[model samples]
Target: MGNTVIEKIIQAHTADEVAPGRIVWMDLDIRSARDFGGPNVVKNYEREYAGLPLADKSKTYFTFDLCAPACTLKYADNQQACRDFARRNGVEVYDVDSGVGTHVLMEGGLARANGTVVGTDSHMNILGAIGAFGQGMGDVDVTFAFRTGRTWFEVPESVRVVLKGTFKKPTSAKDLTLYLLKVLGTKKIALRSAEFTGPAVAGLSLAGRLTLCSMVTEMAGIIGFIPECGAEARKEIESYTKTPYSPFSPDGDAGYAETIEVDVQGLSPQVAAPPSPTNVKPAVELRGTKIDSGFIGSCTNGRFEDFAEAARLLIGRKVKKGIMLKIVPATRRVYKELLARGILQDLFEAGAIVVNPGCGGCAEGHVGLTGKGEVQISTGNRNFAGKQGKGQTYLASPAVVAASCILGHIAGPEDL
Candidate 1:
């Protein structure tokens, strides 16, 4: 039988049996832990091998993006523990100033196309944007990988997802993602691998693909792969690999558990209401829903394009008097680019607050949170109750969040 994207990567990484439902030990190209569960991983590793050397210390990493700069005393101590452990073990830590761990891996080319990576971040599968096999595992699983540089994984069922529309003005990749969330929901995609195909994936930029694959976890799926990389993305990938970039493609007759089709034509801006990411509806339907706060950054949608698009809406307009808008860049690189373009100045003049680059506010440990009984329209993924704050958080695209900041209510940029 033919192989899918996930199957091809599995074959490349392992010498064991390869088939759906088969569990085997595969080599990992990169292993990492974030500030959130990094302390636990350290504890586990020491208990197992106190005086032993790591299997591949050079390939291991720790990212301090979650609650970076130590939001609480416990977090501060935890981060310090990781730093000390990394020092003793000779592993590297990406420090508080570094951006999200997922972004760090790809930007550094540590997780390359057609490779395997495992990390503590649930959204580590975001690496699928570059055609890598990535998974999120518990601290114990990571500890073993730290010791041996390999982990057990079940070859998941592959699902073919055909997207059938092109994006128009004011309608974005996030909307395309939400539209899929509404159509595919959880049951259809849960526990399976989805390979995005069709017109939408043909000309998608790296940023847009990142946004599209970042949310696979919300719907309970395995990695979301966009196997086709644009020329610019290939150049960036090859820059770190120091070689030509050759991508993986599924076989023409690849075996799939199912084939699902999603049509984004005539789709309006979509927003996931409170309590569930799959609980989505059109943005216009929720118009005039009052909001007290706004946020425009997350690993999913915190690229330079996201910020620049928001700046386009805020250039000549000031944020509403009673509302607070927070802008955070995902990486120091993106933050520097924003400064070079004076995007921060435009946002500042519009009464918006620009914070340092990192995974800001999405974890509820940093800024951009809402209070009791308040309402917020955010660009971050997942609006589960109390995830962002006690107040309700409605998930939308960057354009919608920027427009809402100006009107102090749920709004879109198209009619602005």
Candidate 2:
């Protein structure tokens, strides 16, 4: 049987024939940890190795991404511990104000396409958009990798997802992901690798692919795979994109446990209501639903395109009375680009507050937290109860979130 893209990657790393359901140990091209669990990883490493040096300090990265800028004293201390550890060990660290850890690694050229990356953040699978076999593990797993430079995985079965046609305007990768979650159901994708193919996926920009793949964790997927298209799609983006990654595709007649196809021409903007990402419906269905806050940022949808699209919608309009709109770029580079383009200025003038880059307010306990009994619309990946404070969160595309800010209700860009 022909190997799937993921299978090909694993085989190359191991230099041995491997198949689904088999356990294999492979060398990691990159290993990373973030602020939330990084301190614990450091402690574990110290406990295991004492004064010994890390297996490969240059290959490891630690970033202060979660609760960046230190929401409180405890968070600040945690970040400080990571910083001190990186300094002493000579490992690379992306400090607060740098950006999300995954974005930092990709932008810094550490996450190579067709390479194996293991990270402490589940959403690290977003790297698969570049054809890397990115997997998330626990802090202990990362610590083990730091010590040994190797990790194990049970090769997951593959799910072939073919996207055809074009995404209707105002609908984007976020909508595509939501529509997939709605049809596939989160439970069905658990522990499986999703390989995106067909013409629609080919048309997605690298940033859009990042947005689509970033949310695979929400569906419990091991990774969301997008086969490399070609040189044009593989060109390195300046400042925002730094990595030059080789592309790979599944062999014809590759084995897949299931195949699903989505035609974007008929797809509409979608929203996942409070308490579950799987509770999805057309964005039009949720129109007129009042919201107290709207957010446009996260690893999933915080790219430059997201901010520019949102700024376009909000420039001539003001955030509705009594509603707070928060815009956060995913990285310092993106933030700077937004400022250079006057997108940040336009957002501020429209009554939207542009916060520092990083996972702001998406995971809560940071800026833009909502209060009890309030309603919110966001471009974040999840809307689980209390995920962003005690209020309810409705997940939508960045365009939807931006339009909602203007209407003070859940809405799509078409509503504008």
Candidate 3:
């Protein structure tokens, strides 16, 4: 049988035949660690490698995203450790304000089609949006990758998901992804790679594809790839790369462990209820659920397009009295673009708190952490308790977050 997209990439990187379940050491194009576990990686590297030089310092990097700006002393020290290591080794550091590492890597062109990148961030697989192979591992593994310029991976069995029909107005890629979570469930995709194709995905925008792949981690997937990533994504990849970058595609006769289809004809805005990303349902069904705060940012939905959707509802409207709405762009580039478009001023006038570009509201101690007993609707993935704070986090699209911010409850765009 012909190979899947991951298999083909692996073969090229390793120069060896690959199959599902096989383990191979693939040369890495980029290696990184974010602030959260980055210190551990530095410690491991120093302890294990001692005075040995890295295989290639140019490919090494440190991204400060999670808890960026050093919310606490411990985090501050951790970030400093990573910076010190990068300074001594001549490794690049996408510092505190740079944004989410995954987005930063993509924006900088280090993560491109058919390339392999490994990092400490669990959401690194979000790079698959552009057809790259990105994986997240523990600090020890990352240290090894830093020193050797390679990492071993177990080829995952691949699944073919065929999406039929188009999204109606008001529904978005975030909604479609939540619908997938509701139908496919984590059990179905756990440890397996999924290749998305079909009419529904053909004309999807680059931001939409990024939204879809960013949530694969929530689906318990190894990676979720949207191959044939259109001209927009290709242009972005080509603009950053020194060499020609062709997105990887599966062979026509590629063997899939499972094949499934999703009809998105009537899909609507969706939400993952408090405490779990998998507990997804139509947002309409949960309308009126009271929310203390609303957050419109994260690697998943913190791009310019995501905020633009929210701006449509907030430009002339005010956040409900007593409700706190937080707006955070994914990267400094996204933040600057919004400023240039006047979206930033409009958001501020709407009574929203627009913070620096980074992973806001996505984890504990981040920009929008909820207080005890509070209920929040956010664009970030993962609602697991204690991750976003002691209070509950409900995941939804930027449109939903905007509407809910104005209405004081969980709501859909139509509610406005």
Candidate 4:
């Protein structure tokens, strides 16, 4: 029987003939936890498992994203639990580096080359950067991965997002995703998989793929995958994979419950109207809308490449007089790399504030939050009302966010 790569992987882990839309229990090949939520997951593990050793901890994975340093307090307290648990059962915990987000870390090795992965955090979809069927689950399910190395999934019907045409303007994958959220409301595809195909996606960088899949959760989808394409994809595959790395694509006859095509030609930068990621409009439509704050950071677009993009635009310029711009790296490693590259100095001299990593201004809970009547442009994942501060939050790509900050208003790279 022919099945999609994702379906085949899931079926290999199960004894049944898996089909789309069927709920079935299967073993998890890998599981990861981050500092943001790892401590609590460990606490739950301690409470539920009670001295029971994991069936095979070797398959269990733990990573110390440690970006939210403050949140590590819980991890500190629970380290013994995690360490002892891992030692007792043979789990591998990554503590040496913090290059990217958890989702990025999970895909570091063969984990990305076509496998079924489950994580404790929502952005687990980023594993799709290398063509993996990955999803986020509750701590309970993660705990099960530690014990029995398995979890359950109701195989999702796929939704194909066919990207056509090359980008005519400076629009980014971030803009494409914002437009997507507008097309597919937040709650419409709660447990579906988003499959990106067509020529547009075929040319995108691996970073672009990560950005697209990372935000799939905002649209309420459980999984996102892009069939492998280009040397960019091959480079990522060779980085962590010892096994043979083969690219995957949907069968020509593979089924999709819905399909949407986005044309990138002449696409303008888009912003999510206040209060919702799905509430979006073209940036040009928001001309003359002054913003008090601008942020460029978060796992979605806080990589070194994102920093380089912003620095390229802000090197000789200053943020507008009335505007306050904040730059956050996704992790300390990214922060240090930017510092080494002198991008840090360029950003600060350009009148932007540099802050510690972690969700940053993305979710609006901390770091450079907005005040009443304040308007901000950011590269964070969502712009839902009060998402960053009670003030207005418009989503844009890193370049757009940096350029808009210098202009004190909504603008794109071209406007710079």
- Tens digit of lDDT per residue, candidate 2, span 339-389? 999889999999998889888776654565889998988888888888788
Candidate 3, residues 223-250, lDDT tens digits: the string is: 9998756666566567666567677789
Could you tell me how far off, in angstroms, the CA of residue 266 lies in candidate 3 after the best superposition? 2.0
Superposed model 1: Cα runs more than 4 Å off:
235-242
Q: What lDDT does each candidate get? A: 0.88, 0.85, 0.88, 0.72
Give the better candidate number (3 or 4) by lDDT: 3
1 or 2, which is superior by lDDT? 1
Local accuracy of candidate 1 as per-residue lDDT tens digits, 113-188 = 8899999988899889888888998899898999999988899999999988776868888888887888888888
TM agreement with the true structure for every prediction: 0.97, 0.96, 0.97, 0.88
Q: 2 or 4: which has the higher lDDT?
A: 2
Return the candidate ranking by lDDT, descending: 3, 1, 2, 4
For all predictions, the C-alpha RMSD in Å is 1.3, 1.7, 1.3, 3.0
Model 2 TM-score on a 0 to 1 scale: 0.96
List the lowest-lDDT window of 10 residues for candidate 1: 232-241
